[model samples]
Target: MNEVKASMAGSVWKIVAKEGEQVKSGEDVAILESMKMEIPIPSEADGTVKELKVAEGDFVNEGDVIAIIE
Candidate 1:
């Protein structure tokens, strides 16, 4: 299993990948809102989304695990 981590602190804006969805490396899985900007969170590896650790509007810090990929 691989963990997808947040690159910066922000509120989750949207989740683009769903559980059991297959994702490629560098694919945007979620979007984060911070400082009036939208930051896209990308997957680090090619795999299926195993779990989402957060939901829309949830706050997250840098390095926080956002999703589990396998």
Candidate 2:
């Protein structure tokens, strides 16, 4: 299993990958809004998205797990 972690502290702007969706390494799984900038959170592993830990409009800190891939 691999965990996709948030790169920065921000509110979740969008979730690009859904549960059970296939994803490749470096693919954007979610986008976060912080300091008026949009930051895309990428998956570090290639696999199916097993779960999403945060929802759109939810705030998360850096290093927070965004999703699980396996």
Q: Model 2, range 1-70, lDDT digits (tens) per residue?
A: 9999988899999999999999999999999999999999999989999999999999999999999999
List the pairs of residues colliding in candidate 1.
none
Query: What local lDDT score does residue 30 receive in model 2, on the 0 to 100 scale?
Result: 98
* Model 1 segments more than 4 A misplaced: none
Report the lDDT tens digits of candidate 1 across residue range 1-32: 99999999999999999999999999999999
- Candidate 2: C-alpha RMSD to true structure equals 0.4
TM-score of each candidate? 0.98, 0.98
What's model 1's overall lDDT?
Answer: 0.97
